[model samples]
Target: MVSLRAIVEDETTLLNALSLTIPEREELASITHPAQRIEWLACRLAVRRLVEAQGVPYAGLQKDEFGKPHLIDSPWHISLSHTTGWAAAVLHRSRPVGIDIEPIRDQFRRVVPRVLSDKEITHAASDLNRLAVYWCAKEALYKLYGKRQLTFRDHLHIEPFADHEDQLVGHVRLPDHEEQLMIRCFRTGPGLLAVAY
Candidate 1:
């Protein structure tokens, strides 16, 4: 099970109202881009919101060797993604998960050959926003897959589907393990948000 939380503030707003722990503040301080810092701030705030709402006291967070974030004192799994105007986080107490948010853009067209398989291209419905949604799905799946060596074109694939649903399925084909993933994307004001688990 995956639980999602999102906030619609831009990075500047989050920085102005920053409420992060010392370590999280240090992490934000290390980010060079103002916008990137904002994304990081938004994600941490969203996670705190989720944790507080769940009746758990927000604790510190830690990173695994891969730099994936997790609670320092809890068993819940976490994944986060942030874009220009939004930040999102996913929590699953029992399993790994991933989440991403991206604006609908024609940019996916330039990377179609690199990110989508032939089947996925056909599945993308020839629309830029649809393509972005599919692209975000593959990305969420990749984060859930957790290894950095993945090539979206060859290793990640989404089954063909109508573009009208809030949910879709993706496949990860590694040399040793092939699995189906459940993914969902939603319109977030000006962007698309996707989650996989």
Candidate 2:
């Protein structure tokens, strides 16, 4: 089973509603920036909700050297993503998962070279939102890969698809591994949400 949740951040209620245990509080205490603090809390809360729904007590989360988050002493896989005012989490009983939340921006074009191949750019064509879809789909796939080393332009590939489609498949190729990821996209207010597994 896979559980997903996304919520717009409310700074006022975030702290009041979140009753983080001492360890979880310590994990985020170093974050001085308000935005970062909010995102961190929102993600933990989302994950907390998922685990609670599944009748599992919430454990603290930790990260590996690659910064992929894992629930302490739990076998379930988790992925998190957030922007300034939104956060999302995905929990999977067995399969690995990835989720990303991104705000569409005109500046995304400037970073196209770093994130997309020539063919991908051609596939996105002149439209900007389609570019957002490609960028977001790739971001989700990158998170799905979990490791920190892969390059979006080199290791990730997004097959062409309509911007209106509910889902898309992403490809990953490495010297030692290959995977086909199923990614789903949705309109999240002003930004985009992509989840993969």
Candidate 3:
């Protein structure tokens, strides 16, 4: 099972709203862009909230060599995603998990060829909502893989589903190994969230 949470707030409320370790403070300082810093803070605070909800001490986060964030001193696997003003996080007890949030936009139409495969493109039919779902699903799959070698069009595949469906099938195809995962979608405030595990 996976637990998910989303946080939406203004810049002032999020600033210094959560406790940070020395390393986390330094990491925040290293981020130069104001928007990026806000995103970083929001994601950390959101994930920390999830950790505390489970009655566990939030020891902060650590990234593996592949850049996947893991809960320090805990057995939970975690994934995070943020866009503009929304940040989301997912946690699973014993399985790798991925979650992505994205707002539907016209730009998905332009990036269709780059993000979706021929089969997926045919299934999407240039619809913005479908394309947005595909994008979020693939991004969740990519984060689940937790490696940098895969491409959306080549390695990650999401089976076609009907409009208004909340569940879909996703496959991560590699040269030597392949695994199928179940993906769940939710209608978040102004966007869609896809969770793969």
What lDDT does each candidate get?
Answer: 0.79, 0.82, 0.85
What is the full ranking by lDDT, best candidate first? Answer: 3, 2, 1
Model 1 alpha-carbon drift over 4 Å, by segment: 1-23
Write candidate 3's Cα lDDT for 81-182 as tens digits: 887777788888789999998888998898888889999999999888899999999999999899998989999999999999999999999998899999
TM-score of 2: 0.89
Which RMSD values do the candidates have, in order? 2.6, 2.3, 2.0
RMSD of 2: 2.3
Task: Decide which is better by TM-score, 1 or 2.
Answer: 2
Answer with 1 or 2, whichever has the higher lDDT.
2
Model 3 lDDT, full chain set: 0.85
TM-score of each: 0.87, 0.89, 0.91
Candidate 1 vs 3: which has more lDDT: 3
What is candidate 1's TM-score against the reference? 0.87
TM-score of predicted model 3?
Answer: 0.91
Q: What does the lDDT read for residue 165 in candidate 3? A: 99
Q: What's the residue-level lDDT of 105 in candidate 2?
A: 90
Q: Which candidate, 2 or 3, would have the higher TM-score against the true structure? A: 3
- CA shift at 79, candidate 3, in angstroms? 0.8
- Ten-residue region with minimum lDDT total, candidate 2: 1-10
lDDT at residue 94 of model 1 (Cα atoms): 82
